[model samples]
Target: MEEMLNNMREEDIKEARLMLDAAVAFRGAMSSAMRREIMKRFCELAGLPFDEPPTIVRRNPFEDENLRNNLQKFISEWCEVDEIATCTCHELYDSFSDWCMCNGLTPPTKNVVGGALRQMKMFVSYKSDATRKWRGVRIKEGEER
Candidate 1:
């Protein structure tokens, strides 16, 4: 496992991030219409049928910002989402959870809260873990504080 991890390339890291971002961790109360729009956007991004092999192979890492912007628009256009009311607290939590799992992080930090607190905690947990991992790598370098 260590050798496998050591062999992972920069492209692998980039692909992982792109894949995670492309995944819709939280779609605020989407309806069939909204889902259709999302599918359309996905198809356009992929430039192939939805049934294509490797259901998620068309992600464009360079188009992250554009895709994010479009995602927000689609979410708003299809659903009467309330940034306050309709936005569930666990939404962020779910995102964090998904990111953690997607990144192969161990012992996922579970968000027990059902509201905003949960989201905040999940974000903090992921950030904290990321920070610790960065620090560990830096320390291993023996060239930085």
Candidate 2:
């Protein structure tokens, strides 16, 4: 590999370096599974042996039984699953945070709450005006934050 690189023109080497740096930057934004897959592909293309890494299981933030139960309770009391109901992501998160505070629980971040809502099988969509919202669900009539 050193001999091959030594034979390359300076411009070629510079371009290769730039490409590698870009790949590293891109990897930082990718999920672990995606990174591993990309690494495996690179190894295959380079004719190198690729050893599979041990799988690292990540615990879901909302996986705690107690937390899940509390979230469900909150949904039951504050939200409705009507077909025509809709709520924006920001509004839902604000209301969820308020509910958590009222119930003496630390509110998770908006992203975490969004993930929990997705896990609960809530359908997400955007309005005609490009506002993101959860479809078929909305806060109860009197539960607006």
The TM-scores, one per candidate, come to 0.19, 0.54
Misplaced by over 4 Å in model 2 are 1-58, 143-145
User: Quick one: best lDDT, which candidate?
Assistant: 2
Prediction-by-prediction clash tally: 0, 0
Residues 1-145, candidate 2: write the lDDT tens digits.
5554466667665654555565689877868777676666555544468999887899888665666677788887888877788889888778778889999999988777777777767566666577778887788777352
- lDDT by residue (tens digit), candidate 1, 25-105: 544555645555555554444443564334446743334453334333433333233222233324433544443455464
Question: What C-alpha RMSD separates each model from the true structure?
Answer: 23.0, 7.1
**Top candidate, metric TM-score:** 2
Regions of model 1 farther than 4 Å from truth:
1-23, 50-145
lDDT against the true structure, per candidate, is 0.37, 0.73
How many clashing pairs in candidate 1? 0
